[model samples]
Target: MENNSIWVGKLKKLEPSDYTMSILPKLRIHEENVMEFLRLSASKPEHITEILKMENNSILIGKVNNLIFSDYAVGILPRLGIHGENEMEELGLLAEHFEYISEILRMENNSIRVGKMRSLVLGEHAVEIFPKLKICEEGGIEEFFMVTDNPENITEIFRTENKNISVWIRKAKKLRLENCAMQIFHNLKFQKENVIAEICLSADCPYHITEMFKMENKSIQIGKVKRLELNCYAI
Candidate 1:
């Protein structure tokens, strides 16, 4: 038989501390695999949380209804933490559900005409989707709003210098008065004194306009008439 005893003796000659240190990398690899297995086998929320605490290094967090993970998993895991493929898949599904719920909420009408039952459903859907909506300034307009749904088509409407402002006002709900020099007479005919005109100095429009109804010298807030995204579902 080969002298296996000689190799054993050589290993024994190393200090106990040295031997322990040498195996640490391998032990960590094994521990990572074990944690991954546990994550896959986890069926209940409690089990997932327990496993997550053990592998607290993982960027992914699994909850009863949601799973959160980093956007870049493959590049991030070995450096920051580790996660199993199955865990990533579960996280993807959760993200899809979040997106779906958000789209439903955005498509639902929030107008004054919606009945109580429909309004309740829309409110619930809005709550569910609020977290996922992407918010940005609408063409430098400071008024912040959520864009839950993307429009399928976009059309531009422009009026000439001679066109009646009143006609455009009646047709427009949102207005983008960017690069034009025109005074809009509000609640008056050919009267520039009570004009609500916006001026643009830059190549890009400096101001955005939304249509409002005036009653008793007060502006009533109707739906905004800026660049709007219309849904196919909207009637």
Candidate 2:
């Protein structure tokens, strides 16, 4: 909504408050909202350019299909909550055309692809979209947390990087990791005896499974026992 008055012109000048009901909904726009329209219209370059210009040439992010991996997108990625230039470099390696990203990662509508993503921040309802995320590699999602049942979903608590990874899946019934390769963990312990063990034993890249179930059975269970499953390789 940068310089919103320019877009609305006379309408915004005439009826400032009513413009929201008259125009914003048709454009599906709200200030401080994640520019999802960029994702939807990424395929059309002209439309993308037009939208970007309309938004005062804001950053490009979120499944920007078919567009070039230009400096514009790279510069704005950080604003979209994407961490690290290394992660953007990995994204650049995916394909020349950004559209190939969706095909390569098997992305679905509203699904998040965490492949090569170093940091992951999720809310309480995150587990609903867990199946949608394409997680690959050992340290793909190194930082993650699901705080209290409230909306104050913060990621700064107990976050360790590079040397060791700490994840707090509070009240998360099922936690699963797949296709982890070349992992090195100094302290890996399974917190509970009842925790399921389904890890690959790679002598070259040794790692351990640590599952902590702190919540009561009734609180965490989704009609089943709380479990942590990792289908890892070379870990």
Q: Which number leads on lDDT?
A: 2
**In model 1, where is the ten-residue run with the lowest total lDDT?**
112-121
Model 2 lDDT tens row, 96-147: 2333232312334224333354334332323122333444544444333221
Give all TM-scores, in the order shown: 0.17, 0.26
lDDT for 195 (candidate 1): 29
lDDT of 1: 0.22
lDDT for each candidate structure = 0.22, 0.27
Residue 180: error of model 1 in Å?
38
List candidate 2 segments past 4 Å from native: 1-28, 32-77, 80-165, 169-172, 181-190, 193-225, 228-235
lDDT of 1 by residue, 1-235 (tens): 2211122211111111212322212222222231211111112233222222332233321111112221111111111133322122111111112332332233322211111110010111122332222212122122111121211100111223223323323332222221111113233132222222221111122221122112234342323232343222210
On a 0 to 1 TM-score scale, where does candidate 2 land against the true structure?
0.26
lDDT of 2 at 200: 24
